[model samples]
Target: MVHRKHNRVDGKGRIVIPVKIRQAMGIEPGSMIEFDYMARRHQLVIRAVTETDQRAHNRET
Candidate 1:
């Protein structure tokens, strides 16, 4: 199932990720967010960076 929340962008074009999503994804303050845009499908995939993601990124750097 696709869980969803509603947030609107301000004049500066910022969309607030809801608290529910943040807590569910283990995203804390100062956490980094990532996005992947599928141009063909016009879809955006957003994810919170986890420890595993950080480890993999650290390896690349």
Candidate 2:
């Protein structure tokens, strides 16, 4: 099942990801996250930066 939570950005423009969501994604301290804004879709996508993603990105460059 998918879990969803609402969070607000603070004055510093930082928003905290819920611990449940973080743990589900295997996101720990020092884990990198990538954010992508889909202008057409009017949505923001957040993903954990994994080694597989890094390898693919490296190959692209």
Best candidate according to lDDT: 2
lDDT of 2 by residue, 1-61 (tens): 6999999999999999999999999999999899999999999999999989989999999
TM-score to true structure, per model? 0.80, 0.83
Residue runs of model 1 more than 4 Å from their true location after superposition = none
Worst 10 residues of 2 by lDDT: 1-10
lDDT of 1 by residue, 19-47 (tens): 77778887899888899999999998989
Best by TM-score: 2
Model 2, total clashes: 0
As a whole number from 0 to 100, the lDDT of residue 1 in candidate 2 is 67
